[model samples]
Target: MTTTTIERQRLSIQTNPVDAEFQQQLDQVFTEDACALLVELTREFRPRLQQLLAERQRKQARFDAGDLPDFLSETKAIRESDWQVAAIPADLQDRRLEITGPVDRKMVINALNADVKVFMADFEDAQSPTWQGVVEGQVNLRDANLGSISYTDPNSGKAYALKENPALLIARVRGLHLWEKHLQVDGEVIPGALMDFALYFIHNLAQRQKMSTGVYFYLPKLQSHQEAKWWDDVFRYTEQKFGVPVGTIRATVLIETLPAVFEMDEILYSLRDHIVALNCGRWDYIFSYIKTLKNHPDRVLPDRQVVTMDKPFLSAYSRLLIKTCHKRGALAMGGMAALIPAKDPEQNKAILAKVTADKELEASNGHDGTWIAHPGLAATAGAVLNKHLGDKPNQLQVLREQDAPVTAADLLAPCEGERTEAGMRTNIRVALQYLAAWISGKGCVPIYGLMEDAATAEISRASIWQWIQHGKKLSNGQLVTKQLFASMLDEEAEVVKGEVGSDAWASQNFERAKSLLLDITTADELVDFLTLPAYDLLP
Candidate 1:
């Protein structure tokens, strides 16, 4: 944290690290040849990554100027033309239910052992990317693939290890926007996505090859087919660098951004050689809906709670994604059902029922699989998906070409619901607490019976921003303004303190989190990702 330490660390990118144990592990993971590979990937891909990011700002500028995102005219031929993605590996087929969590050792073991088809060890939304956390994640995943991972809880004296026939592991790297601040290749910090992809791919490729499983990934926060192409390039380049076949690196892209939905076909085609599926990242998609359409009054969203996947816009998005992916010979995966199990039996039953209904909807609509956060809900999702799947590995044959045609209007429909003061307070509390945890080295936390992560917090904040920008009125008839939002935030911070208790509040990062929330929520310009500024505070 000292200036001297910063300068020393800044100049020692491929050399020593601050922590001795971390440095030692880094030496092993970033062996002489591995370091050379990272350097090459970073230098080659970083330029195109910058250009793509710049293009995003340009596109957003147009959107802000009242230009709506629609299916691209240039990609029409690609969309209408006959095409299909690469074959799904045997292990990726029949992904009835996948559990996702941060990549700490215990969570990795438990999630992999969960009764699901895949466990996405998330380095993006579900993880707080501290220097130690990211490297430790690499070590954990390396051990996991070798079937040597084990953990004995220091608090409970319980040991955890992988069970037979564990869920297939898929690593979700950080989004394109994030950078790995801890390590620099040359004078600049390398893209976090590149580091995550290269390290995990290189470290685990041998074992994966032995198992004939290949290396699988979940690509997040893409806004266009061009971005998808960037990933495809990385996959191809890495495959070549490692002397593996081009198809050895497979990905399932998350159509999480508003712009991405319009480019699904092109995205699938771009990565067809490496892509096997597309997932409805509903939470970030909602956040992107608000962020991308912030300037349009007609597109303003309702409460975070009421902006469910059942909404017309979201329903249409999912239906369209299913049609597109299935038409292209790829599995159309559903979004997350992020409800944690409650302690009360009745409450837990209600939670499971919600998950069941959600998965059932996805299944009936022809999705191959669904995502659930908790291991407890796996059986519920599995049973529902099983009924639809029957003996088939996937619902790729259920191509909903016969369903009513979806258009841009359907995808941009205004979300229907009432905006209430209670909902605003809930948003305040959720973002405040989520930010508190995020800055304190945890990205996924359970709050109020829901498993919350960066995406949910994003929806909460972005909805508030869009509502205020458009001078929205709550059902209570209070006009939303900066003063009103500030007053409510002050009140909600107290409510959170009361709920979480004063002692814990004083010890935790709530105050710093509150200042951050207040700054972003009431800023004149809508800030992009809250993680950008929060990343600066990470150790």
Candidate 2:
């Protein structure tokens, strides 16, 4: 058989080849040997993935039936036990400011070269899982770790390259539920999360070890300690298969989901040997909050704007993260300040002040570090964290035991505010704009002066569904029906078409974005995630 045909056999699926040259590169990454290993790994853990996902649905049903989440009683001893995660490595000691962005090649370079202590290269929320996008992102990260990544714009002739003293890299792989449809092993498509994590860990381990920085990760969407344990098992198996030390791979778990927030201690304990911190994945946490309690009328959230961290439930979640992490000698990392630096001086000044206050609260409350979405906000976030982190790697020393105890009521605090027509219109606009960008293979977009990702879009659509499901009405006494949302979407489409001009508006992607947004928003039943359906539209 020809070499090209033989290579296709290894992938065991009919995927359109990017080109011979690119195919060769992919062959190297997904060689028969590598595919065989991944097949084994997938088979080993696929059942657990199924169970965990099923558990998620089961838990959701209970929530829908009026049950509220609380601390896991079965894991009480694990939480009450006196134990701490493994020691933090020197390179990961001070994560004062971490910048997050997609795994796009230019973005990878910019984020690494940005002035932050750590740059989380996201393969989950900030990236569309196109075959090219998924595979090329791996190649970019591989080159970035080796200091050989660069890009030149074909038209503008502008160039990008990594600078000296680049931020340490952390990879955030996809969650358990998503899978790559392009490449299959024995007719089964590989889990996208495994593909992302395995490809990075396999390729970059040696380079990072040579640099002595280690392979760090950010774990996303974990709903239970058992899920964390599943990841822990995966880590163990990966290290054993690769001949690395057991705890060589360190990860910071994102306490984003409502169920995850309740099991913080248990989650930490489950991955104690390979964990260094627990991050407040705030954007998605808010989305998950709405998803978890959507059945309860009283739990319906107000305008997303008013659901700030100071709100009862969010405040409790934030403080509890700090107290739990500090007590266990782990870092309590804060969530993203999603504001980008605006051109208007007054607006930028106001946003900076707000970020400063947020960071100050986290620092004073014993957080070790925080996240900034844009490079410009890094310095501002750093300044606040530095005030508390001065001369010390982290505030892991500050045991927040005296902080007010966070109870189940605190975590499930009922939402309080007005639902306005302005809010509904805002959600419609942002969701459409983001969907348009995402369908165009851009997962991260700046809309209305804020950097948004899949998490933001998730919140946008999930909130709409909750509003419609619960028959929420705006201050104008209008019910949030599908027709109401579609009408606003139509108006927003015209506004966007005008903003982007006729050339963009007439494009196929723009049309698809509109159709996709309408489908998700106005569907009879809520779509679990917009990305799942959107993934089918990718090349």
Candidate 3:
């Protein structure tokens, strides 16, 4: 290493400028002891993390060569064994309605006071992770834990603060694929997951103590049991370093990836000491469905809108998950209801009906709880789950084991729907607008009455790319091609411009978003994620 890189390894990565108040919070969060823990983590586990990521690329190569992911033959013994995860903490028992948002200060305050069962402050898909967003997210969570977070709107001159009995708080860290580029150790970027976890864990020491509830987490996008083990080790290591009990840090894993679906048993087994549940991250699961099977022409999915929870493949996935999780004594939480409360009265009624129906499907399928993106959705979703749970804290006893109809074929079954021109156009428009907002440092944006985050954006572009790759014909009988997508993209950009108006079109990063989206959609090879390239746009 160079002299400067070596010297910097001994020092902490400096943060970008924020307001005076946030700078003070930053100083408090990054004490001398905290920096030491960060550097120690970087030195010890960074190599193993890289090895695990390399294994992902290796497995994908096998899949591209016509190998399919199935239950691991080697670990069949573990799957058949009788075991269960550690007990669920009292605070996380009733997660019937959980709301997730980016870790902005105002959002943190609002989500905490939203009267849901849990408010998941997200550092993953929902967070843009600009230097300001990352720094302020930590600051906001610390203050929220202390019951002192507040916000005063500059535009509306309105004040906001947490309510007396706020929802339970959980921090969802970034996936293994993302690196926090703002910080480096030994001339390399640090894993964003580690950064979020370390900072959140250390800063919330008081929160854990004062509430007598150990730090809880929501782990995202883990593709295999090995990744879950990595996180489990990190949790135990952090607990040991802090001198807390080994199982003090509990977590719920999002089974968002296709490979992860087949390994639910192994994943829970690996993290049994520190895990309580497995969530059905439906959007990312759909994105993974396309990405993992991209080379298989017969498996090209239909419209994004048609890929709802009730579809055969998705229902099978959910049923199998409910059976697996409950059998293993873990909660099977449902997916996000991304509907925003529309302003039009009739439209809002339809949206509520949709959200309610979705939660009903989950509750009936034996999911213990469900996720909602908007606060207005809590009442609708909670009522349905409440009816299912009666007075119980959760639905762990509602196991669907006896009448289960899911099989491996069900999980990988070809999604059935028409590939319509309107669907293709909708994907282009949503992806363009969401990417523009993302590059402009807003990770979560409402487009066309639904919350759009990285997972949904990934589904949009990946679906289009897969369709074009296989030369599939749309419902309108036009073969999807690069030229056609480019044409649709141009038209949709104008449509978005007209809809968002010239001021927004002129002010935001729409042009940059358009260029990136077009390049990825028509590229010869499929890109893994949109955010990897978009992260360069952030400071």
Which of the predicted structures, 2 or 3, would earn the higher TM-score when compared with the native? 3
Question: What TM-score does prediction 2 earn?
Answer: 0.96
Report the lDDT of model 3 for residue 247: 80
lDDT of 2 by residue, 324-352 (tens): 99888789999999999988999999999
lDDT of 3 by residue, 428-459 (tens): 99999999999899999998889989999999
lDDT for every model?
Answer: 0.90, 0.86, 0.89
How many backbone collisions does model 3 have? 0
Work out the TM-score per prediction.
0.97, 0.96, 0.97
* Candidate 1, 42-154: lDDT as tens digits: 88999999999999999999999999889999989999899789888788888988999999999999999999989999999999998778888999999999999999999
TM-score of 3: 0.97
Cα lDDT, model 2, residue 484: 87
Q: For candidate 3, give the lDDT.
A: 0.89
Q: Which candidate is the best by lDDT?
A: 1
Pairs of residues clashing in candidate 3? none
Q: Candidate 2 clashing pairs?
A: none
The alpha-carbon deviation from the true structure for residue 64 of candidate 1, after best TM-score superposition, in angstroms, is: 0.3
